[model samples]
Target chain A: MRKEVRVAGFGGQGVILAGVILAQASGAIEGREVAQTQSYGPEARGGAARCDVVISDKRILYPKVRQADLLLAMSQPALAKYAVDLDAAKGKVVIDSTLVNELPDGLPPVYRVPATKIAEEEFKNRIVANMVMLGALARVDDVVAYDSLKRAVAENVAPKFRDLNLAALDRGYQAVEGPGLRPAAGANDAPGAPASGGR
Target chain B: MSEDGRKVRIIQGNEASVEGAIAAGCRFFAGYPITPASEIAELMSRRLPPVGGTFLQMEDEIASINAVIGASWGGAKACTASSGPGISLMQEGVGYAAETETPCVVINVMRGGPATGQPTISSQQDIYQARYGGHGDYEIIALVPSSAQEAYDLTIKAFNLAEEFRVPVYLLSDEIVGHTRERVVMGGPIEVRERVAPPKEGYRPYAAGPDGLLPGMPAFNDGYRLLVEGQHHDERGIRAGDDVNKSAALVQRLNDKVRKNIDRITDVERVDLDDAEVAVVCFGSTARPALEAVQSAREKGVKAGALRLRVIWPFPEKVVAELAGRARTLIVPEMNIGKLVLEVRRSAGGRAEVISLPRLGGALHTPEEVEGAIMDAVKGGNAR
Candidate 1:
């Protein structure tokens, strides 16, 4: 099966790092094929930056996300800009609700995790918001195995931030169960969040 | 790491190149940082030093290429990396390397441009520039990697070819392939070819042996009197600008050395092309989407296939002609306006209808987009 995940936020939110961890979890730990690409050129500071991770049992043909199965929108503008291309019925969006004041209409199931709030409150650092969202993504969708993500975090993160990153991933993973994973890979209507139709 | 719990590493495309270069005994790296390609220089800075290699961040791209050439002459496997704008600046140095028969590798992590067009975006626009960038008639090996693993494998190939052929070799990649992260399996016991040293007796710096390659390149201060002149010179490395026969022979041999070995130097991947009436010809990161499109078209019962160029330069003419002979239509897709498509047209030779699907300063061709082009090619039904 092919799964494409896109993590988007402003420049300094560790969006790219989060995608790398997801890729490492799937590719390096689980031994699957993964390709990660990002919006890395001349993106202005504070602009909407994004990284795309394509995970597959077979070789990933196209590297970039064609239709994102999961969208981790850490900023309000990121959601506004990238939500249009999210898989309408099957896709899932995990947003940092503390920063996102509102949600666009007609998106797939959105799990509002308030990643920034949790990162600041529990970890004492707001920069780990991307990791929090990734953790929530694991619990909310099971795109990657939760244990592998923890392992990936341990292996990929900097020495200074490794402990905090693991804790942040665990906190997000344990707090919520991916309503989509309970049954099968196909994401269904779960009890955790409402499926938005209109504003 | 492999299924047996071997070392399966997740690395970016640029990082893979560094690992490959290190594996191939490349100990010298000189470059200037450029967007989308800076990571290569950054990683090389950390990578080369630990391997007992040297890393030099020169003042500019020209100095970077020149330094690489100098290092190569100093008897170290050397390379440099840059994007389009910076690579354009290295044209004179590249020519000098070609003229001097310097063995070095230059990685062009291509971006959009005639100038510094799109430092943040990706393009295959430099395809022609790499082959014919300098002022003289010369040929250089250009390998275009479609994935991160290929990036690693081809980089080692680039260094090996540079040393064996005594010509500057290029790994023509784009920002997408350069910056994308993927799994690269490190192979066991990488084979490396070092430049052959000459015998003590009767060694001329610019003279070709019976094998059509220079006898040998002596390291600087290696007990050999080497002039290292870039001007048209005789076998003794002395300027022979006034000697027509010597100048002609020297230049011809430089081009002939690579041309004669084209069969051994070229590599390509063919997918579902057997008995297909329509085929998509592509390279670099664009190849993946084109393959998907061709596969999807086959599901819909269209006789379509894909050909991906692993080695870009040497043109791979025989394969293109063979594909053109069977397939009635050839679709050439590139991230540039029209570079590889032009070569495809030339090689197709009106045997098949050649179509160019060009994109610029932007994203890769989506499978859907390439599928649409394939469908159109099939519908057009232009026969040979």
Candidate 2:
């Protein structure tokens, strides 16, 4: 089986790094075929940025993601831009509730997690918001094992920030089982509605 | 393989090229910073010095290519990389390397262009430029890699070919392949070809041996007084610009060296072409979608296949003609406005209907688009 994941946010949110980590988890740690590609623009930070990761049991033919199976939007602009590209019927949408305050109607099972809020309130650093979203993604989708992601996070992040990032990942993973935080099954609610239950 | 057994890692194409260069004994890298290809220079800068090699960041692409040529003459495997604008600037140097018979590698991680078009977007627009970018009549070997693994493998092959043929070789990668990260399996240590040195008695630098190719070159500082110049030179490395016969012979030898060994130099990968009614001809990153389209078309009972040109230059004419003889139609898809397709048509010789599917605007052709073209080719059914 082949799975395509799109991670999008403004630059400096570690969107590209998150995509790389996902690719490493599947490709290097789990010994699967993976391809990750990102868009580079003139703006270094605070501009629109996105990355696509393709994980496959066999070799990947087309590396680019035509229709993403999993869409992780960390910003409202990214959500507005890439939401239409997701598989509307079967694709899963994961968004950061703190930043993306709006959601388009008629999306596959949407999972909302206040990634940046948890990163700032608990870890006192908002840069690990993408890691939080990744953690939540692992819980919603069992395509990639949790151990593989943890190992990938440890291997990819900077040596100095490795500990805090690991903590952020754990917190994000635990947040999936937190009170009222679950994968909403086909429920189209307001933009910042709390998570319902796991898919 | 990381100094151990078989190793696997996730790396981008640019990074893979660096690893491949290192494996191929490329110790000298000189390049100016350019987007899409900058990561190569960055990795080289960080890696070369620690491996007892030299990395120089030249002021411009001209200086970079010249420096690479100089390093090659100094008896070191050398390379330089850039995108389209920088590659255009280095055309003069590339021509000089070709004429002077310098063995060096030029990596063109191609981006969109007529000029400074798009820095980060990918394009195979440099297909024509790579083959005929230099002034005058000359042939250079160019390889197109589709994935990170091929990027690594083909780079080693590029360096080997550069040394073997004594010509400036090119790895024509696009931004998509250059920047895309994928899983790459590292092979065992590659066998690097050592440049042969001439005997002490009666050594002529530019003279062709019995095989009609220049003799192995001695390094500049290796007790051999060498005169390396862009102008036409005689067998003894002296200026022969006034001697028309000498000039003609020198140029012919340079061209003949590669042309004679075309079959050995050309590399291509064919897929599902046995009973194919339609064939998709493509190269580089574009091959990814083309292969997918071919498979999808086959599922729908269209006898479609694909021929991916790993070695873009030397044209692989015989293979193209053979495929044309078998398939009823040939579909050439490229990111450019119809560069390689023209070559396909020329080689096809009207034996098969050649169709061009051109995509510009810095976007790759999706499989759906290529499938549509394949379906149209099958429906047209106008094969002679």
Candidate 3:
């Protein structure tokens, strides 16, 4: 199976790192063909940043993502910019409910996770929010094995933060189990409605 | 794999190039940092020390190229890398390396051109610059790689060719190929080329052997008296001082050393060209999309094929001419504004219809774009 994934957020959200870990999990640990590319403006931080990871069973002919099969948005601007490019009929969308308060109408199946809230409240660090999103992605999609992702996170993170990041990942994986966390009711559903009913 | 049994690893192209250089026995690196090419310098700084090699971040591109040449004469396999603007500053130094017959590698991770255009974007705009950037009539070998694996593999080939031919060789990469990450098989036993050393007894540095090529070099401070200069010199390394015949012969020999070995130096990856009616000639990152376009065209019964030029300089004229003779139409797509297509037209020699599909402004040609051009060429329509 060929899967094209895009992870987008501001520069400091560790969006590029999340993409790298995904690529490693699928390619190095799982022995699959993968290509990862990232782009950002001149600003070092606070500017929009995005990464594209293409995982395939066969040789990848084109490296860039023409239409993303999985879209992970960590900010309002990133979702507004890239959500339209997702494959509407079959694509899966994941968004951080803590930062992104709005969702477009008539979207594909969307999984909303309180990634930043879990990192900030449980781990006392908001920086591990990307790891939380990764965990949720693993739970939502069977693109890569959960064990492979755990190993990848261990290998990619620094020694000091490895334990905290892994904890964040586990919490993220469990976030999808709460009730009323499916796709929003309709296009006109209230903003921030998905996260209020869940812990 | 090496004897230690290290397997494949996913790495960026710039990192792969460094590994390739290290595998090729390159012991010295000097370069100034530039965007899209800076990763090469960063990795070299970290990796060279562990291997007991030397890495120097020179003050600028001018100093970097000169240092590379000096290290080459110091009996070390040396190289330097930069992007377009930095490469522009190193032109005089590159010319000096050519004149002195220094065996060194110069990598230009090409970007959008003319000035400091598009540092983060990729472009094939340096095709002319790689060939004619340095002044005077001289020849240099240039290799263009399409993937990160080739970026690793061809860098070793670049160094080997540089040492074997005793000339400056270029690995013409672009931002896309340098920055993209892919699976590159690491840890292989590579054949490292040894620099030819001159006989200790009465060696002349500039003397050409019976084949009219440069002889083995005597290392500096190796108890052999050697005078290296950029001026016109004779077999005994003495200044010829505007002696028209001697200077003309020296210049001719310098050019002939590479031109005579053109057949051995040229390499092209031809795909699906057995009965192609339309052919696309491309190189570097652009070849990726061209390959897909050719496959798509074949599916549509267009009989489309592709000839990817692995060696851009020394211009694979013979292969191109043969392909042109067999195919009715030739489409040349590049990331620049029709620089290499002119060479393709000249090589085609009116044997076929040569079309230039030039895409500029820091964007690559999609497979759809190339496929549309191929279809247009097959219909004998003038399409840009």
Query: DockQ of every model listed?
Result: 0.73, 0.78, 0.60
* Candidate 1 lDDT by residue in tens digits, A1-199: 9999999989889998999999999998998999999885366567678999999998888888878999998889989999998999789888888888788999888777778888999989998888888888887776788889989999988889899998888666655333333422333534434433311
* DockQ-better candidate, 1 vs 2: 2
Query: Could you give the CAPRI-style class of model 1?
Result: medium
Question: Would you list the C-alpha lDDT of every candidate in the order shown?
Answer: 0.87, 0.89, 0.87
Q: Which residue pairs clash within candidate 1?
A: A139-A178, B1-B7, B1-B8
The weakest ten consecutive residues by lDDT in model 2 chain A span A183-192
Error of 1 at A185 (Å): 20
Model 2, B196: alpha-carbon shift in Å? Answer: 2.1
Model 2 chain B lowest lDDT segment of ten: B208-217
TM-score of chain B of 1: 0.96
Each prediction's TM-score against the native?
0.94, 0.95, 0.93
Clashing pairs in model 2, backbone N/Cα/C closer than 3 A: A182-A197, A183-A197
Tens-digit lDDT string for candidate 3 (B1-384):
446665687788888899999989898999999988999999999989899999999999999999999999999999999999999999999888888899999989998877988877889998888878899988889999888899999999999988877889999998888987889986656677877788878778888876667767668888878888888898877888489998998889888888888999999998999999899999999998899999999998888999999999889998999998999899999999898999899999999989999999867788999999898887764343
Q: Where in model 1 is the C-alpha error above 4 Å?
A: A41-44, A174-199, B1-6, B382-384
In Å, residue A43's CA in model 2 sits off its true spot by 1.4
Candidate 1 has a TM-score of: 0.94
For all the models shown, what interface RMSD does each have? 1.3, 0.8, 1.1
Predicted structure with the largest TM-score when compared to the true one: 2
State candidate 3's TM-score: 0.93
Compare candidates 1 and 2 on TM-score and give the better one.
2
lDDT of 2 by residue, B1-384 (tens): 566566888999999999999888899999999998999999999999999999999999999999999999998999999999999999999999999899999999999998989988999999889889989989899999999999999999999899888899999999999999998877676667777888857777887776666667679778886889789998878999899999898888888888888899989998999999899999999999999999899999889999999998888888899999989999999999998998899999999989999999878899999999999888788542
